[model samples]
Structure formats: structure tokens, C-alpha cells
Target: MDHAETITLADGARIATWTRAGPAEAPHVVLLHGGPGLWDYLEPLAGLIGDEATTHRYDQRGCGASSPSDEQSVARSVADLDELRAHWELDRFVPIGHSFGATLALAYAAAYPERVPAVGYVSGVGIGDWRTPFRNERRRRAEPFAARLAELSVPQRTADEEVKWRTLTWATDYADLTIGLRAASAMAHSPHVINQHANRAVSFTDADQIGWAAAVRCPVYVVHGTADPRPAANALQLADRLARPRKRVVTEAGHLPWIEQPEQLRELLAEIVQAGRC
Candidate 1:
């Protein structure tokens, strides 16, 4: 929360960036929030790190405060990160990515293994067949709101209705309905639009992800939540592919561990930063 600025990419896309001050010699940690289209929402998670490590977070091109673009792909996103690291003058850093962002982080590491000391993959849906099970579990959990959710999911919806629809849909990501509803409501921030094209274009299948993992030369922390409907087994699949993967599972946590288990996630990230320093 200390600094904010906008950086222009080679493609002329403007990306909004933020920074939190930490020790000059501390490990640099770049946080990648999930969603191919959603804006940055890792402020709380970033706050947990405090001054332990210098942190940089930004809206992916065409998301949040970033400029929209007709071109979106995994390669472009990885290139963007490398550009940002150069702009930030970071020699090396750890990329902690959540959800889809986790996949992006892995791709970055694979593309530039020399610049990445480690990677944090949190709540990621690995390149496995987790989508089917996730959908089934989400369907079971969302039975109470199914009718309304379907109604609001139509092509045209008022802004308010869109938020409602998103809340109901995302609420299924939590194990506790009460906390899930509250957290999902907060995540339903304004200007929220899911870029279906970006989601599809920037994603990787398990087969391709495995190929990418082969190129990664650093250690990867594959962190997952036990109660996260996405199936922790998917995380294991990703871990198995990494050259050096450390898997951690948070008990009773849904998708976003920072919300339900801030201290635990904080400890894990702190450990990662410290390890990167060594």
C-alpha cells in the first residue's frame, strides 16, 4: 500500500502496479492474484507479509486497472512478468500465484528459471481432471442458490445482478457458508468482469503443464486447502511433475487460505521468502 503506479507494456497496454515497503535486502516477492479477468484482490494476503519481504502486485493486462487487449495468451503473460521484473529492477524473486495465477507463475518459472528462486502455487487447479469434480462439488454445495444463480447467469444482467450471481457462484468455494457468503460478497468488487477468452487462451492443460514443469529448474511449493472443492489430488499431480516440489495442505480451509487461515499461510510464505534469501 505504500506505492502505486501505472506501467505501459510493449503492446501499449497499461498495467496498474502497487508495492509494499520491506527491507532493502529482503527477498522480493511478486504476488499473482487469480482470475484471467478479475482485478487484484490480494491486498489482505499481501498485508499478512507486512515488512518481511518487499512485495509487488499488479493487475494483469486487461484486468482491473490494466488496459484491455485483443491479444491474450500464456506466453504474453509470462513475458509481461519478465518485463515487470526488469522495470522493478529485481534480480530474483518468488512468484506466489493463486488459482489460475498459480499456473501463470509456473509458466514464468519455466520460461525464466534463472530469475525465479522458487514459486508458490496456491489453491491452483492443476492440469488434471479437477474441473469435473470441482463442478460436481460446487453443484452440490450450491443447490440452495441454483435457481437464482442460473437466472442471473444469463448474458445480459444489471451490474448489481452480476455481483449477486458472482457471490452465489464463488460462495461455493468456501467450506463455511457464512464465511463463504461474506467473503464472496467482498470479492464481488466493482468493474468485475470475467474475460472468458482470456481465461481460455491463457490456460494450460495437464499435458502442456507437465511439459512446462519440465523446464522449471527451481523448487515449487504446491499449497492447497483440504476442504477446497477443487481436489487436493490435483495439487499432488502438479507437485509430482515439478523438479523440486514441496506440498502443503491447509486443513479446514476453503479456496482462499488467507481469509480462513491467515497465520498459517503467512508462516508458509514467510518460510518461502526466507528460503529464497538463502
Candidate 2:
């Protein structure tokens, strides 16, 4: 059983929380979680790599144990990814992202496919326009969503009260967590990291991400729930425009497919990772 660990970014900010449960020298796989603030998501994912590989999960700054600062940017997060790879002395490794994390992974691979071994995006989102397909569903769903938000304990909530009480849940838990949102919130409490991750993500865009997405030169597989309300469709739209070896769509699941359907998701991911590793 490997243990958890932490690392500091160049800014001297302690921006990571991770778990290592497989062979230390095996293929290194990094899990990029959603929630600009959330980062702690290794527990459930630890099992996937088993003895075959090494897996690490971490929180973005301002979430979990990471110090909060005003230097947040999709570009900075991308820099953080680059920094982590260099810090780990990794010449190449697989990068996987869930929802917002998925988008980041895509952006990362797009920018540095040479360094990224392979990529998998679960319930991925893009940084673009806001869609409230459920705006009225908010009438029917807002109360339940808000109620769920209020139900979270402090560590699970972000630093902001209303977001802790509102936005985080809508973005991550709109479906089911036991496997999804909770996995995402492994970073900061939701109001702080998770909600902030979402707030920053939906609208996050870097000229690099767009250029990178267009130039992604490797295998990219995206898994999303057919039943997933918003991000699911968005995942498909991005997939359509992507180059060959790009897979998009995971049906019969919702936004939290990694947890809602971990085994299947893991199997699908395994195939893509293997292909990329080849």
C-alpha cells in the first residue's frame, strides 16, 4: 500500500495532495480532478492502476491543503501540470481528467502531447459559454440541488458560503457522487475549490487550449454519460472536431460516470491508456 504525499509548486504554494498505491517505478499516470479548488480524488482511483502502474491524484491550489491565492488561471493550472511532470522527473506519463479536469487534460495533451502518454476524459467540460438547459429544471431541481449543497460538511464545502451552499453541487453532483462529486471535491471544500473550479472552468479559455485542441497529436478518449445533462453534449461537440484516434461518448451514465460506473469506465480507460502507451 503506497501512501499519500504532497508537493510545492514554484510559487512556494503547497498545491498538491496525492496517493500512490501501485508499483513506484511503473508507468506513471496522473489524475487531474475538476474543481479549481478541489484536488483530493485518489482514493477511488487507486484501485484502477493496481500493480500494473503508478497513479497520483492531487488538488489544484486554493483547494484542499493548497494555499489560496489570486494567481488562478487555466494557463496557470496548465503550468502547474507542466511543473508537476518536471518535478516528478517524468519524461512521459498518462494524464486523465474528470469533467473540468478532463478539459484541462485535453488542453495539456493538446499543448504537450509529446510529454503526455495518453489521455482520458470522464464527464468532460469545455471552457466556453454557459448553458442552463436546466434553468427551469432549476425550478424543479434548484431546491434539491441547493438542499444537497447545504448538506455537505465543512471539508466538503469551499471557502465561500453561498457557493458552498449552491454552485458546487449544481456543477458536480447534479447526478450522483458516492463516485463522482465527492471524488471531485477531494481538493478544497466545495464552496472554495470545487465551486471555484467550476466557476473558473466553464468560462476558462486560453489561446493555447484552442490551438492545442486543434493540434492534439495523440489518442484521446472521452467518456461521458448519455444522461449527463450539460457537459455530456459538450464533450461530444469537442470530439466531433477532434482528429483521428479521438473517442467521445459514454452512454447509460450521467455526469459522474467514473463513480457511477467505475468498472466500465476503468475498462474503457484501460484500453485507451494502453493504446497511447504503445
Candidate 3:
């Protein structure tokens, strides 16, 4: 990472932002991480493309090193991104998002089409209806693990217990249990400060909740893992919705492509940035 800083929004919320230096005239690429509340895990991935473009990553408000805030809705998230863009003096750039971040990126593009040249969505949670299918898939894959946890008498009542359950459940997210365990171990040290209030505030009843895919005026690159519990069909459907979309499915990967398929992720991001420059 080139440098890190905290930008205080107009509302007094501070956002932790990082920028990896690249070519001075290169197109700016902002990375949006998943977990409506997770910080920037894409830093390593950012380094992979630092030579090609000016890459940026940040902890959304109330996530990572950023100060906590009661205002954590999707609209607030988009506004914060807009503020970051102005703070960096960027007129337009490419936004690449993962999971929930991908959803937010789409929302941002819909709200400010003129500000985004193109978008890259990886393992993205598409359309509101994705929840049911995702849940069923996750449950099906996690059954054995869930049973084992039950035998161990793991309680799911408290916040800590919920975290433990979620951590263990993450095994279903990867094709390899060892990788899942490693990810869970890393997450154990980090603060899982999710903004439940903000999560409840945003409703995704319709595809138009944010900006419909038809409204996006830029090219969209959609990447998903075949082994990801979240249905691949959602990605294909999302690609169909976008005005201009390119879809790629990695066979051996799961939900966390950066961890399972970093090179492919890096190439896809470079492609998006290069396309934006054209």
C-alpha cells in the first residue's frame, strides 16, 4: 500500500482509505470489499494491479479502522464513496466490488452513471431474491459441519456465539476446508462489528431498489466461482441485465475468489481498468 488516511465525512463519520501508487496518469480504480461491514481485504489483490492503475481501497463507515456510525445504509455508503472520489479529485473511475460490495457498486453506478467508466463484480450477491437460494445452498453444504457443531454443544445465542457459528459455517464457502479454517482464523482476530441497524434499513424487494442494470451506462465484468454456494445462475442473470457485461466463471474456486484464484482476479481487474481507459 502506498499510503493510508482517514477522511472525515461531512456528517462527522470518518472513513479509513488506502491508495496504492501507480502511474500518475493511470485511470483510478476503487475497490469495494464485501460484508456490508467488512474492511478492505482486497489490499493484496490491489497490489497485484498497482502497476497498471492507481488502485484504492477503503473500510466502509463503521468497518475496519473507520470510526463507527449509526448511519450505515446503502445510500450513506454511496454518499461516502462520492465524498472519497472528490477528496481524491477523481472525475470518474472504475469501481470493483466483491459480494455485498458488488451490490453497492451497482447501486452507486446506477445513482451516478456519469462517474463510473465500468464495473467489475466478483462473487457478487445479485438481485434481492438471491437470499433464499444462497441460504439453501449454504445450509446444504454446511449440514455436516452444523451437526458437528451441534454435537459440541456450541450455543448460538450471544454475539460471540453467533460469530463462532458463522466462522465455522464459512467452511461451506470454500472448496477446501483448510482454506476455510485459515480464513476463519484470520477473521477471529478482527472485530466483526457489523452494523445491524444499517443492514435492516436497506430493503432489496425489487431489482430497482438500487439502480436497475439497464440504467448502468458502463461495461460490467461479472466473475463468479463455480463452487461458490451462491448460485452461479445469479451471476449469469446479472450479466444479462447489464447493458454491457462480460462473465467469467472459475471452476475450482468458491465465494472468495481472491483467496482461491488471485491471478484470475488480478487479470479481470486489469481488464476492467484497461477497458475503462479506452
Candidate 4:
């Protein structure tokens, strides 16, 4: 693994990061991890991108080792990505966004389809006309999570304090279900910063997000799961919207299929990148 070095933004935020196996000359790849404040924790698929892709993984504004959010909001997170791409002068990029990262990637592709090559959208949001379906599926899948969350009370007097408490202790509070995000958040971003970022991310909503995804001309590969509780029907709905040439729905994995089905992910990715424009 080649440690992710930094290219300071004009705003002067020191972002922590690293890159995985690929030559400097190879085509650039930007791997997007979900979990708004989850940090840069996706390492399983980095090696799978092969030699042709120079995979870049970095902490979001307030996650991982990256600089804390400049403004602590979803708009800022999206802006950070845009700013980073501009700063790097990257002509074309392959966005491999997983889970929540998938939603962000779709938003980016929809907003700036010209900057992207193709998208490896894995178990992402249902940004098509499947909001009700996706929402129901999320409710179904998130039930267990929500149940667990319900059991572990936010240990605060008021809703504001609860949010603050969780914001500071998200990694700890949701440690088990989230795979130790508390320590990662603590090590990478502070509670205040993570909470602010979460506030922005949770508040993120755009009716045009789905409209943009529908209008995007770029090819998309959707790797969804059969057993994974989250977004089950939404995946099919999204693929249906894109149709065959630009879509693929994996039947065996769950929310994070890159980790669950790496080979399938690699094959689909290779197919998409090799197929070029639809």
C-alpha cells in the first residue's frame, strides 16, 4: 500500500490519506466509501482494481485521517471532492463508490458526467424513481440496525445533546455494528467535526439527484445483493431504469458486495471499463 500523500486545498485543510497498488502513470481511480463520517476504511477492493487503475482512497472532510470538514456539511463534502479533482487537474476518473459512497458517486456523475469515465456503483442508493421501494428496503434492512440502536440509548437529556453525544461518540456508540468507527472517528476526525459532517450528510436531499442519475450518459455497473437486507429491490429498480447495456445486478451479495463478492465485483468492473461507452 502506498501511503496517500496530500495536495493541500486553497482552504488549507490537511487531509490524511493513502493509495493502493498502481503505478503513477496509470489511469486515475477514485474509490468512494460510504458511511458519511465512516472514514476511509475500504481496503478489500483496492487490490482488485488491478494494475490499470491507480486507486486513490482518502478520508472525507471529517473522516479518516483527512482534514476535518472546513464547514462541516454535505455540500462541503461534495465541494471537497470537486475541489480535489480540480486541484489535481484529473481529466477523467473512474468512480468506484460502495454503499453510501455509491449515492455520492451517482450524485457526482449526475452533476458532472463529463469528468467521469464509468461508475462501479455498488449497493448504492436508489437514485431513480424507486424512492418508495428503496425507502421501504432501507427500512427493512435498517430495522435490525435501528433496533440495535434503539437498545443502545443515546445517553443524553435532550435530542440536541443526544446528537452531540453520538456525534462525539459515534465510533464508540455504534462501534460494534459499524466495525469500530468510534476509534477511527476519534483517530481521524473529532466528535464535533464528525457530528457536523453527519448533520450535513443526513440533511442531504435533492429531488434532482435521481433526475440527474436518469439523465447521465455514462455506463453504470450496479453490484447488489440477494441476501443483504439493505436496498434489495432498489437495486433491481435502478438497473431497470438504466437497462442492460449499462447495468449489472449481482444476486449473491449484500450492502457491501465489494467486500462480500470481490471476484464478481472485479469481473463486472473489468467488463464495464473494457466495454467503454455504451
Candidate 1 local distance difference test against the native? 0.87
Compared with the true structure, what per-residue lDDT tens digits does model 2 show for residues 212-267?
Answer: 67878777786777657654555666666567546655555666665566677767
lDDT of 2: 0.64
Instruction: Pick the winner on TM-score between candidates 2 and 4.
Output: 2
Among these predictions, the greatest lDDT belongs to 1
Off by over 4 Å in 1: none
Error of 4 at 271 (Å): 2.7
Q: Where does model 2 exceed 4 Å of error?
A: 127-130, 134-198, 201-203, 206-209
Q: Which one is best on TM-score?
A: 1
lDDT of each: 0.87, 0.64, 0.79, 0.61
- Writing each residue's lDDT as its tens digit, candidate 1 over 1-278 gives 55998998777889999989898888889999888877788888679888889999999988878888768888889999999999999889999999988998999998888899989999988866898999999999999989999889798988899889889999999978789999999888567577777777776677778987899888888999888999999889878988899888887899998888888899888877776786
Q: How far out, in Å, is residue 49 in model 4?
A: 1.2
* Candidate 3 wrong stretches, greater than 4 Å: 148-163
Task: Show how many residue pairs clash in every candidate, following the order shown.
Answer: 0, 20, 0, 10
Better of 1 and 4 by TM-score: 1
lDDT of 4 by residue, 109-220 (tens): 7678888767777766664444565456444544544555464454343545454334333333221334434343433433333444464454444454446567667777
Report the CA-based lDDT of candidate 3 relative to the real structure: 0.79
Clash pairs of candidate 1? none
